[model samples]
Target chain A: MAVREGLLALLDEGPRYGYQLKTEFEAATGGVWPLNVGQVYTTLDRLERDGLVEVRGGAEGAQSQKTYAITTDGVAALGAWWEAVPSDDPPPRDELMLKVLMAIERGDDHALKVVTNQRTVLLSLLQAKRRERRVMSDDSFASKLVTDALILRAEADLRWLDSCEEQLQTRLRAGGTTRPTRKADR
Target chain B: MTAHTLPAPNHAAVEFFDVVKRYGSGSTEVRALNGVSLRIEPGEFVAIMGPSGCGKSTLLHLAGGMEDPSAGRVYVAGRDVADMDVTDRAALRRREVGYVFQRLNLLASLTALENVSLPLELEGVGVRQARAEAREALAAVGLDHHLDRFPDDFSGGQQQRIAIARSIVGRRGVLLADEPTGSLDTATSDAVIELLAELPVRHGTAVVLVTHEPRFASWADRVVFLRDGRVVDDTARTVARSGLGAVS
Candidate 1:
């Protein structure tokens, strides 16, 4: 989704050929978001059509041989992109929360099971992310930033699961439901 | 089995064989651990997790020779704990096992250096020798500059680091930590955990941690899940990683 602005931003550094843009983009993003030559040329064509980029001679489809430079419009668009903040006006739909809600309808015991199962999966993911973070170099800010974001999100979800388990247990102890709480099937 | 009939020694740092611990007798009895068997190898980092009353603490107590089991033998450093007398057990604890509970037991009057060297001093190591080893242990936990400071002089995180330094000071073979980060905030908790993750490699000590926080448990090489006194699941990481190799 940000590929168009990414390409324009790359061009802002000066004119770059198709292959050069692809390698620089991957390097800039820590190689997490990969771009094939086809996707790069497609985005470049759109940018040229919108006047965000200009080809420096040669044929249009001959991307590798042709260089691209950001236009005045491209600079303005890139500035806007830099200033834009991601919006969360409406709460994003989360699959974990949705599954918990559906599980609650089935029963507390079922919901507890779902929470436990999800917790294990998230823990494993967090472990792997931490290991990956451990090996990263001190200067790999891009990778570190992305990895930290992911680790924090997983930790937050695990905390939510803990609360869910606590509430379920509290209700069970108070005899709030008629159904018997089954023994843990773990 | 009698101590004389014990099996041949193996390389496990600690092992619990069909161990059971119960309180009271008959109808009034409550089983804290039920036929649980586990082994922790040298330099292995294991995290024990479970709901309340799931025997996590009991498992730790047995590993440290702090309690006796009703059934099966508990071995530390390949010797049956039941075979040891009280003095031998005390020496075993002083030499082979170290514990860090939620309550940091640093004496208020002692400096960090003294607190770390006290155990060694008690075990009859020369005062100067104990102090030298204490300095190295404190340095391992990043508190070398503050060794002369009393526990009251340090922040919660620094105090925890001191407690950890005390645990590993004498080249103990096993470190049993029970909720060591229970009182710290998230960032401090992470620092404490990261220090713990390094123990196996830095000191060649096997670590057994009991924690309710999955985030902390994720740092371990293996996670053992206990339920109703029995092990429900034991998950090991796909690869074993040492803390020394991680970013500081």
Candidate 2:
């Protein structure tokens, strides 16, 4: 999501300065994403221009710290973003899927090797994530959510690879023909 | 000149001797297995892949002494299961073979620690010793903190791990997992597969798994494919390409 929307959401809580918004954003995301102070200010400036936020006050002088609050428009924008499920009209390009496709298209004995190599890499990644998830405490709820999602996605990918391998072997058994190509999957 | 042929190395952990298993009789007779003979060495992992009725489960049942062959002898850990009494067979299974059933079958009332340790305690291991082994098994499958939780409280994936922990509690020489990851999500399945792959070296256990998924077969040292109650394709090779072999 854009930092613009993020800043709006943070301001929706109440008036907060740029530094505080940056810190809260990182905290909300389990500190996995680091945000820059300059980037926060830049996004906040855009939000103000769009009339989604306004500065609260200049405490002492023109150079005094200023907090920003979300306007009605900002709240509306945040609500819309919350309810909207992001589009998946076009599937994301997956490198492993692409590699398997290329290997199959080339029509050599290399398909098994390619699939095996990719599967090995993914399995190792999955094992590490599982290990991490195992160590997660109840306090690290955000991190736990992130790791849980990761572990599920990794597993889905592995199942997809398993299906691909099964199909490939079946084709080989049926007198060596390439499978009908379909669009890449998650 | 007399030439010496090197004596064959004996490494079979479970050997099937022309085993045949048929159900029903006469016109309705269903031959679930047809003279299937195979061998699994200690510290080696093998997989059985086949269609639903190709007798993969039958083979595993025979290997674990849960079923007797209709026409042949079944040997596990160097003893003929056909010759053993009920108690002897149960004892053999307790000490040598670990079966990871498809249903998980975790005792609902027991805690994860208790469930995993139950098998060891039944085998007459001291309570303290069995609990310690249970702790290590659960930890091996990454369930350290969940030792106190019951199966009802765990996620499907976590419960599966608990099942695995229960299976490996005694460090059994042979592990027979029937569709071990069939109920798991892909990512969680990967973790289970990694653990199965490590069993040979981690606990000195031989694994004979039955999976429809070919990718899981990749983790195994051998793959035996069955069709129409007969062995169609069985291949054995080193697992260096799996990378698990090279990893510490």
Candidate 3:
């Protein structure tokens, strides 16, 4: 996500320079996303060009340190962003699903390989996310929220994997291409 | 079976491959674990989670050498229990695995120190050395002060902690615990899980915890789910992942 909306949201509170915006953004996000001051300045310049913000004092490095304030239009934009229901249209392109689909089209063992490798990787990711959430949760609600979502999603992915494996095993049984595991009758 | 230590964080301290455990025969047969493949490395924590009779306890038994597999292999600390004779398996069990059950089965007549040291003493360690190690283990779980107290004198959580201290006193390579926190309150459960979670890191003892609770399982590096004797799901995200919000 761009730091644009984040800076605008900060300006909604009060006028602040690039450095202040950067620091505030870090603080708000639990220091998870550390914003570069140069990126902050460039974003501010764009916001100014777009008339979403106005200069309160002067320019960069001024003794008074010119602050940026949200314009009336910026307020409307921030409100719109907040009110906008996030689009799920594109439906996050999952690379593993694509790989599994392609492998199954070949009618071979590659699907099993893809499923097993990804399962291990995702399992490790879930463990790590849970541990991270436990550690950082005390100080940062932002990080806790993000990690919680990650852990939930990872768990769902593992269930999906079980589904995939079951389907493959069924297919294998129908074809009489034998593997060690007996098909679970249930 | 020959028992040799596998390299830490690489080889699995406990392993199962196409494992099947069946009870009874003809007409009354029950498959407790069907073709479950798993690996838990030294310094790792794994939770076997599922509803009751889903084979969670059976899996723990397989890992800890408390039972035999009807098919496939079970490895404990690099030693294949499947190939071992009874004596060899018993030797490997004593040297490599420690079990903590749902009930804190400390001898009611014995004090906390004696309860924790009995396993060591049974393994033929001198009473002095066993008691000293048991004391340290108790201290690790914040139970050193209660050493002279008997199980009857302690709360349920304290008894459980003493059970844990007993399990780890020998520093066995694999700690197989079945519902170790089931009897505790939420806070006590969290504290017990935290202690179990720390075992692998603190003493290089791998843990295979059997829990039906998702929250308790969250402390593990991986949670393996079983259903009707089959491994339905195994989810992992290693706890060892470090850095400034790596996901971010």
Candidate 4:
């Protein structure tokens, strides 16, 4: 998502055509950031409108190729955008939590079965991702980081699921028909 | 049992006992409803009139069991609605109460028939049976012709009629109208009120209408006036004093 601003900053180094910028951008980010030709052109047009970059006329005969250079305003805007841009901290969106809540509301043994099945599937997925991460090259730091984060989150989710199962068992023993009351409601 | 006499077991359709609703807390606390106790009889059509911020809607919501009374109980169809959980209360509303609001809140994407079938679908009724029942309800509202049309395609009165059809489709015993005729012109409002008045006698339903206009309230069997969340006055009459009676 930061590819557009990253490309703009790279263009600040010197005037370059779309393909040249694309290649340099890939090299800078270790190929983690990929851009289609269409995306590159679209970002360029947007940059030009924001007064961050200027599109100079191409060489006399080469009408298809146009060069772009970042303006002083563009450089300032990019710096501001970089400073203003908050770090990505993706929140947990546990579908398992939703499933458990609805299941408890339903107050049936079927919900417990669904939760058990889902946990098994999730554990298998976590193991496979871990195996894939082990074979990945040490140089692919971004790929390794993404995979490690996913595995850790999945493990935490499994722990939560286990606790939920224990809670469900306790509830089932007390009375199968009783509704799960929210703590705040009590 | 005499042929003319009905059973004594049939009690009032609505009862509120020492009901209190407070907003905020401590120094800022505002009591919207304060120990309000009242009963609405079965087969009677009543209108609640009040000024803004007088807890008219809140009272209606409590009577309909949409919200819980902070200190007291609300009973609908002789069942203690306050004792039920939120989900059960919602089910009670779906099965036993019909609500009509000033704004016809019909989904734009769904046709009139689809809108009417929603309550039944939510109640776990079969799709075919729900649709059949929805069709019957629409016909009762004289909207069978407009069943296939979307809410946006119909006029305001027509859309409101569709909303009414949706509310009554489940054959709910108690009809709660919250400013049902607020947005309509005089003629259309009269037409809607006429349809509403006829429903009780026709289907043996109880109606509780909330309105600001005395003219609109005139169509009710009794008018209960609320000022500062308390019933300031109520009519002694047993039927609507207006000229129109039992529409054919």
For TM-score, the strongest prediction is 1
Candidate 4 clashing pairs? A52-A74
Candidate 2 chain A lDDT trough over 10 residues, lowest sum: A177-186
Error of 3 at B59 (Å): 1.9
How do the predictions measure up, each by TM-score?
0.79, 0.56, 0.62, 0.52
For every candidate, the chain B TM-score is: 0.91, 0.88, 0.88, 0.89
| Candidate scoring better on DockQ of 1 and 4 | 1
- DockQ (Cα-based) per candidate? 0.28, 0.04, 0.16, 0.00
Q: Write the per-residue lDDT of candidate 4 for residues A84-119, one digit (tens) a residue.
A: 946554554457888877877766565666555555
Better of 1 and 2 by DockQ: 1
lDDT of 3 by residue, B158-211 (tens): 888898888888777888888887778988887888989888878888888987
Full ranking by TM-score? 1, 3, 2, 4
What are the per-residue Cα lDDT tens digits for candidate 1 across A1-186?
899999988999899999899999988887788999999999999998999999997765555899899999999999999999988855778999999987886688878777766776666677778889989998888889878888889989988887787788688668757653446522
| Separate clash counts for every candidate | 0, 2, 10, 1
Compare candidates 2 and 3 on TM-score and give the better one.
3
- TM-score: the better of candidates 2 and 4: 2
Off by over 4 Å in 1: A59-61, A71-76, A88-118, A164-186, B1-9, B22-35, B70-72, B83-85, B124-129, B142-146, B185-188, B237-248
Encode model 2's per-residue lDDT on A10-115: one tens digit a residue. 8888999778899998887787778988888778878889999988886453422878899999999999999988688458777877888889876534675566
lDDT score for residue A48 of model 2: 84
Write the residue-wise lDDT of candidate 4 on B43-131 in tens digits.
77777765566678898898888888888888888788866888888888898898999988899999999999999998999999999
Residue A148 CA error for candidate 4 (Å)? 81
**Candidate lDDT values, in order:** 0.86, 0.79, 0.79, 0.76
